[model samples]
Target chain A: MKANEVPQDKSSLDSINQKELCYATDESGNYITTKSSGWTPKTIALNNAIEDIKERAEEAKQRVLNNETSPIEYYMELNRMDVTILAGYVGIWPFRVKRHFNPKRFKKLSDKLLQKYADAFNISLKQLKQGDLNED
Target chain B: MKIDFKHHQSAHCENGVVSNLMKHNGLNISEPMIFGIGSGLIYCYIPFLKVNHGPAVTYRVMPGLIFKRFAKRIGVTFKREKFKSVAKAKQRLDENLKNNNPVGLQVGIYHLLYLPDHYRFHFNAHNIVVYGKEGNNYLVSDPVIETVATLDEKQMEKARFAKGPFAPNGQIYYPISFPKESDIPYKEAIVKGIKQTCRDMLAPIPIVGVKGIRMVAKLIKKWPKKKGIKVANHYLGQIVRMQEEIGTGGGGFRYIFAAFLQESSAILNNEKLMELSKEMTVIGDLWRDFALEASRLYKNRKATTGSYDKVSEMLFELADKEEVFFKTLKKAIK
Candidate 1:
């Protein structure tokens, strides 16, 4: 990792024009800070993580459409959360959160509780209630 | 009101925040010096703990400890507060700003609107400095960014109280009292930092320090055979991101530590530390090479079990290098 050897792979991070500061060695093997657009390895890793999250969100949306679970499931996955994390955000117990994942339970959820879920996912009441994954 | 804070960009968030805040308080400590004095580098692979839906792998010490440890080592103390309510948190923050005080805050990155989407995630251990306020927005110095940024009240509140796994809980800290800068024991602190890091890396534990590196290498070896290729690749991605991603300065803080060592060598007038610094940089390079190979495997779906094995072999080498590196480091300082 020479100072000039710092990679500029132009990944998603670079798309925002924010270069991350990285430490590399100079010709004398002395350390120096160089701003890098991004590294190819990090970009690939991040892209794969994003792809997996999107895939999971799609699966959750399909399950909601089929009435296997509620729209909260779809939104939770969309927000990159699992049951435990979503529960933490909504300030609900994990057991109760899992119960809300059931379509029947979600349908009976009070507006107050539904609002909490909606807020945690940063979506509107209508969006959470409709539970539609299609881009609108 | 603004506190006249100077922001110096660094590879990592906590070190940058701590260093910048110290500078604001009239101390000129480099980011690597802060990282080194804090003993912020470590390798811990917790199998049971899951973050990002994969086994938790920490490349640094737990969040918030670096500042705490750094302050303690330098014989200074920070006024630390965490509020349960967002309103109280905002009030305290504004009070500090009104007094022309810049404070470092532990915040969640997910809801920080100023961050790029690619870097924003559910991580709650991110640190930033709030230096001033103007009308509706607060002036922020996120050291990873090249320039200053801003966050309105609503966005600031959300980031401060972001829940789930190491929640920030509206934590804010600022130095209240300090010895004269000359009395700040750099020599003793440097020795202690080096000794503690050596102790940590050489600890005879299964899942921490050098042994932790070995444990992860072994797990990587068995991952493809035990789990499917997809899951194993996901796990590998977790490790790589933790290492090379933003804030690490690449090589899981190894380069930063090496830089620290290089600086420490000049400070302590120890030729042995200078040689060790070079060795640490070489170890950091090995870690980067490992990441490059592993990332390529997951990037292309054509990766075979043999490829995972090769990556695992790379990890084994890293573990060996780190083992010898820490041992020699321990003796060098002694």
Candidate 2:
């Protein structure tokens, strides 16, 4: 890619005030590091990934509202943590993490364990216990 | 206390850290040179490995190998450590700072409070340089960022000890000594680096190098039929992310390698390398073309039916181009 040909499309990276460093050849074919605000292809891919995360969180929230799953599931999706990643952060096994998604099992979780979950999600213990997603 | 570390931004982290550290230690090495001599460029499609529920597609060699290889090639030695205890990690880092040494750290991108929300993920292989500490905050030189950023003690601990595959476990490394510049064998290292890359790309393994790109092309053709649209799209997005994300510098290190070849031509005084460098740039553009189409397909923007096949065809072309490119490079260097 030529230095002048580097894309400057607006995307989430711009909204967050971050510009990526890209390497492109100058007019003479000498490589140069140019600051690119964004590129269309990269922007689309990132936005698509973010949208997928939002859609997953929305589904998890609906399940929580119906009492089919616990709010932990909602918060986990909201925090962009899958069961495996959330379990990794909470320092627990994957199966046990999935068990906590059950509403019944979740209610019986101890304060210490809830704190771990809260810490993993970077939320307070009260927030986890209340099961409130707040924009509801 | 902080060493006089002058931050020079680069397109990728490891190269940035290595280049910046080398500069600080009285040696000036361009990021592309460091990346090339390290033989950091690679393409591997691991079907069995799943990150974010999609097959792992990596554009570069494994993390840390680039720096390790580069240091060994240039006869520089570095002290490295990974701590199990967060407290011990903190103490060691502070000790290094007190001794006026800036150290490179491997930390998770997630929970790095200073970064924009969109960039943070659960991936644990991100690298940074902690130059000094001021009060509770550590001054960090993250290579991808425009300027130096800061991370507080609480946030730093979380990032350092982040658990997952490739978890850093509070890793810290810094060059202990550098060989005299005149003693370093630039021509020999470049020759070795190019040859190793040629061997890697032309290897007969089905899931590595140029063959790996073809394998992914085959898999892409089957994705929509097998995994459904949503998942197939997600997997496609993952590929683009891995290719264009902060570490790969752009076009999956293609541009850097192109620049490296150009630089190598001058040092070795070989005209063939210069011609090949231009060819590599064209190859980089080809990768961009593939990414553009693949992203458009996933974004559902004017993509027709069977667009997966379209992108897969592009990958096949890339495989062909790279196969020929590496073969030519092998002969040029030899």
DockQ, per model, reads 0.73, 0.63
Per-residue lDDT of model 1, residues B162-215, tens digit only: 988898899999999888988989999999898888889888999998899888
Candidate 1 local lDDT, residue B259: 94
* Model 1 bad stretches (over 4 Å): A134-136, B249-252
Q: What is the C-alpha RMSD of each candidate to the true structure, in Å?
A: 1.2, 1.7
Q: What is the lDDT of residue B19 in candidate 2?
A: 91
The clash count for each model shown is 0, 0
Candidate 1 local lDDT, A63-111, one digit each (tens) = 8888898888788777877778788889989899889889999988898
TM-score of each: 0.98, 0.96
